[model samples]
Target: MYKIAPRISQLTVRQVEQFRSASAWVNPSRSRTESGPEASIDAEKLFINPEVQQLLVELTGMDLEGKVFRARRTTMQQRSHFALMTDERLSETMDKMRREAQRFLSFIPLKEPRSEEVTILSKDDDIKAFDNSKFVFTDITFDATDQDRTVVVREVDGTLRTATPEEHDRMNRVYYEKPNRPVFPPPVFKDPYLQDALARKEHEFVLDWACWFYEPDDPAYVNLVQCVCDRTVDNNDFEVLHSTRHFATLVFYLALNGNIPPLLNYFGGQGRIRDCANLVRLQKRLLPNWRFAISTSDTDLKIVTDFVKQNSRFHEALKDLIAFLKDGVILSRASPKVGSSFSAKAVPKVHISSLLISAFYS
Candidate 1:
């Protein structure tokens, strides 16, 4: 008999919420079913799994998991103004973009000026109006009471309109009420995890903003590169580097944020020769087809040679460098394609020095 391994399934945050809602409906005992003292008593006995509890706390912004319940509220307002030098050129460009958008919208005949509504069974029903158009549609209520479900639509300005009933009754079923998730009032940062995630997102946003504002070869690009280098150096985890999938992902993110230089610098840096050699050895073992540049620069070679001559203990470094150079030469000859194919198959078994050598060659 063959043994079957349990498969891991990943769920999206929204799906997880739906799962929780469904769980509440399915397992009535897990939720408060009654009113008054009985509900409170039942709630005390209903134990939530730690993971679900954490997710609920995150989603609701109420720390009601376990004994640590912290209520937090936050509100944000942003305002900015730019004073132009009364230049007609800038104004003209702005007007042109607006007019272009308007003209593009005019091609779509969906803009019914009269206050009216049109119920749509599915997105396909609105396909005719998909062309650029400025129209307001609102007051959508899904009617779940009827066997032939339908969406009741009303214009925001109060005109009512009805559409043909949908054949699918499931479409009208209310999956769950949108939770009135607690909104932090003002001047408050949420949980540390949330704060960290938000900060990271903001940093990425700023990097994108800068990239769009400046040319690719701008000095800002160099700064961005340096910043990534700093982060790589600071958070140099050898274990993560050893995993090709993990390392590639990290590199991809850094590259996407326009910070590849730091990664290059870290790989080529003289300080981590042993680590680099190990990395190179590992890469060669895992991805034999992939070629990496090992620094054969006179300055680096001479430095290695001098260090070996002065310190007997550093002879290992010389050996690693040689191995790295050998791998680089092989890769160069092979011209192994860059990216994942090279990473996954080539068993990474080289020493840190090999990585350094590969970086130099690169």
Candidate 2:
């Protein structure tokens, strides 16, 4: 009873190229300063991002915004314990701290399924003869399933550990051949080949291959999807991710990392007001303090309007969303049905947000 995991690429509907770059894209404000390569990498001002501020403001409430001053009665108390920092310097320091915190949060990993146990085969004294190439061994017993098979690797430095999920997949492919699954990962997963594939708008293809070839938690797979998903978001290639599963993956990654506002804007620009509403709802559910159980009877418009009423900062970053809703109301003289065809049910109800929050500590 062998079953193959469906390729995300083959399952996806290739999007028709639309001239979306010409459209004014309303996105979270980012400050960019001319410096060097590092500056470009750190250009995103996460502290100023409305979504980040929204979550922080909710969680901290008045503490984040309130300032406390101590009244000094004694002369000793009145004497400053330390030199006072100027407002400009204090602001810069706060921004630096926030950036560091944001960077740390983004790198945090989510919960992954259990990995195979590793068995050590070599010892310190016996490993000196080996070269740099690590040897990976796989158990191919008739009773062993590809997933449950034992795969171990002996490092060149004499450390023996379980094969990484990527290595295990490669070993499995080597022992039990599967069409399109290569023993060695395709060069397309790397450098110029990846760039070329992205340029040709083969994002789905790349994503499918990456998922098929590597475990979902594999670093390479994660990096590849981030690149592909970011490009798809930037280019407004929404049609390229037609599969509900693939779309859910995109949403999970973006919402997990707090980088989903731009995707909402894309939906708004495409006149997908329903989508914008659902996305906002999804974002709210991902926040620790905001995960109140949503009523199944709540309409999309109600969900969005409730959020808009409470969140003043979204007026700017979600300008497209606001305008889209307004236009639909005026034109249709009815509740907008845009993007309703793609139901929120497309997203899995597996407590993905909970997993993300737990992963922050793990």
Candidate 3:
């Protein structure tokens, strides 16, 4: 007869309790039902089974005694083996599924997201050809917080992740860097004297050049001239005599030709004639030919008046000049002797008006 050690029995009891706890078997009803002779027989079989005894000792450091529990021993081994096999099979299945998924992905043609479609619509379509063969893989990581959230795309490296903003910025910088290509240079003034004269507010020189360069048909030249005119106006000291003279000459020629496009285009709009009427007075002294032609006759006066009305602010000056001519005051001041050369004859200051009339007729 074998003597059952009390310590070994107590260890077995602890092992049973531990297994019950791990399996969550706290049913009071089951415990009550199993307290009978049937339960005692089941307990005796579990202690006597060699496999159950080995498993108990290995798993829980407990030894079985007395009779073998064959039914309980078989049940426990089946439960543990089923759990282990199920986990192993699941892991293998997942790995095989992942490989198959990758193979299928390789066969199917992949495309960039449609949001990239507009990149091809640009003028240079040849630079935007799509090639699916060099497709690279990427992953996104998301971080969560109540106040702020961020998502980043990164290339996969085993299990570690890194941001791609620096790479993106570098690519963009390279793509947009200035291209090394030739472009046409702006037109430059060829005349050294004229260029040097225009370097200051040489209004007379500019006026003369404008008169020579005024081509209504060539838009490019006109635009270039206008740019120079604007630059002269901006850089020249307006109060200086040369600056004022240049402005005066510009107005005089603009009025004489009745071609106001350059003035209108340069100044951005039609301006009051009176604003430059003082220029007319100055032109009378400096460009007598211009004044002689403009103030010569009623027709010439009409031309001047029309230009003044269209583009001048000096309405009072125009009215006064028209009134003076009409009243014969200007004619009396310019009384000329017949058959006299304009320069050699002793012509009265009063004859200046007659000279003006003759110049208009000529």
Of 1 and 2, the candidate ahead on TM-score is: 2
* TM-score of model 1 (CA atoms): 0.19
Residues 1-362, model 3: lDDT tens digits: 02322322233223323322111111122221112112112222333345433322221211111111112323346533334458889888767755553332221111111110111101223423333232222212244221111112222222212112233222333333433211221123435654655565353335434333322212233333444544544442222212122333223223323333333222211122232333333323322343233453434334443444443443342443433333322211111122222211221222225544333223
Worst 10 residues of 1 by lDDT: 106-115
Every model's Cα RMSD, please? 25.2, 23.4, 49.1
Off by over 4 Å in 1: 1-270, 291-362
Residues 1-362, model 2: lDDT tens digits = 01212221121112111211211111123211111012111112333355644443332212112211223234465554555799999899778755554442232222232333334443464765578797766678898777566666777787765666667777888888877787888999887998777666566568767767776545466556666767776665655453212455566446544455666655655555466566665554543344334577877656655555454555576655555554431112111123323321121222223433232223
- Residue pair clashes in candidate 2: none
Off by over 4 Å in 2: 1-127, 130-133, 156-158, 291-299, 309-312, 328-362
lDDT by residue (1-362, candidate 1, tens digit) is 01111110121223322322111112222211122112111111121324322322221111122111112222654444466646787788667655553332221011101112233322223344444432332223464233322333333334323422221111222332223212211111223532343334333333333333322222333334334323443543212232111233233223222232333323323233433333333322322233333454534444443333333433342443344333321111111112212111222443335544444434
Top lDDT prediction, candidate number: 2
Q: Over the full model, what C-alpha lDDT does candidate 2 score relative to the true structure?
A: 0.50
